[model samples]
Target: MIVAVTYRYTEDVALRDEVRPAHRDFLRGLADAGSLLLSGPFGPAAPAGALLLFRADDQAQVQAWVDADPFGTRGVVASATVTEWDPVLGTLLPAL
Candidate 1:
């Protein structure tokens, strides 16, 4: 299954910046383990949030990953939502 996670950042820019390296490192680890499919922040302006795609068994698994994220642990993320996604029309992902 594929899960999509959206993270709303806190207004504290300094904190988010400080935590970003660790957060990316964490995501890199997930990617190395074949869990993270894609991830990037919404940016070029003041970042409001980020989107992440993950290969997981279910929503709960993705939610657990979110809970363990550095952003969440350090309070840089104000909120996170996880939802199941069906990729039917994307060449980037195989049809499911």
Candidate 2:
């Protein structure tokens, strides 16, 4: 199943920037392993959050993976949530 991982970043912009590279690397590893499908920041016009898509066995697995984030370990994430997502039509799939 697909899991949607949402992250609410801390208000400390410097801390967020400092941990971004490590966080990106962690996500990259998941993508390389076929777990991460899509991910990005919410944009300046929106709230300070990130959305990540993951292909995983279940919510528990998704939670476990997300809990391993460097940012989370370092307390850069103010809050996080994992939800099971079932896509019907459009998605972030690679172009044919």
Candidate 3:
């Protein structure tokens, strides 16, 4: 299954920046392990939030990742939400 994780950062961009390196490394690690599919922050004068795509067997796996994230541990992320995804129209038809 694919899980979508939406992370909302607090107003302190510096906090987010400070933790971003570790966060990116963590995501890169997940990518290497074939879990993370894509991730990027919302930008251009928008609220601080990011959308991350992951391939996980269940929400618990995704939650585990979230728990390990530096952004979460360091409190850079103010809130987060995870939802299972079903991609029905993409080139990766098998994903559905």
Candidate 4:
């Protein structure tokens, strides 16, 4: 199934800044491993939060993946949510 992992960052400017590189590396690794379908941040002009899409068997697998994030380990994520998404429309893949 497809899962959407959404996370909100804690209000820690220093920690957030410190983890930015590691976070990017982690996402890049996931992309290389073919687990990360899409990822990006959310905010007005910059990024305040993030959304990651992954293909996994169940919620546990998704949780494990999210838990491995450097940002998650550093408490950069104030909260995280996982939801099942049906890709009824998208440009990255063939029409469903």
Worst 10-residue stretch by lDDT in candidate 4?
87-96
Q: What TM-score should be assigned to candidate 4? A: 0.87
Q: Write the per-residue lDDT of candidate 2 for residues 54-95, one digit (tens) a residue.
A: 988889998988889998998888999999887776644442
Off by over 4 Å in 3: 92-96
lDDT of all predictions? 0.91, 0.88, 0.90, 0.87
What is the clash count for each candidate, in the order shown?
A: 0, 0, 0, 0
Model 1 per-residue lDDT tens digits across residues 9-96: 9899999999999999999999999999999989868559999999998899899889999999999999898999878766785632
Itemize residue pairs with steric clashes in candidate 2. Answer: none
lDDT of 3 by residue, 1-96 (tens): 999999988888788888889999999999999999889999868788999999999999999999999999999999999999888787866643
Candidate 1 collision pairs: none
User: Once superposed on the true structure, which residue ranges of model 4 sit more than 4 Å away at CA?
Assistant: 45-47
| Cα-based lDDT at residue 54, candidate 2 | 90
TM-score of 1: 0.92
**Shift of residue 83 alpha carbon in model 2, Å:** 0.4
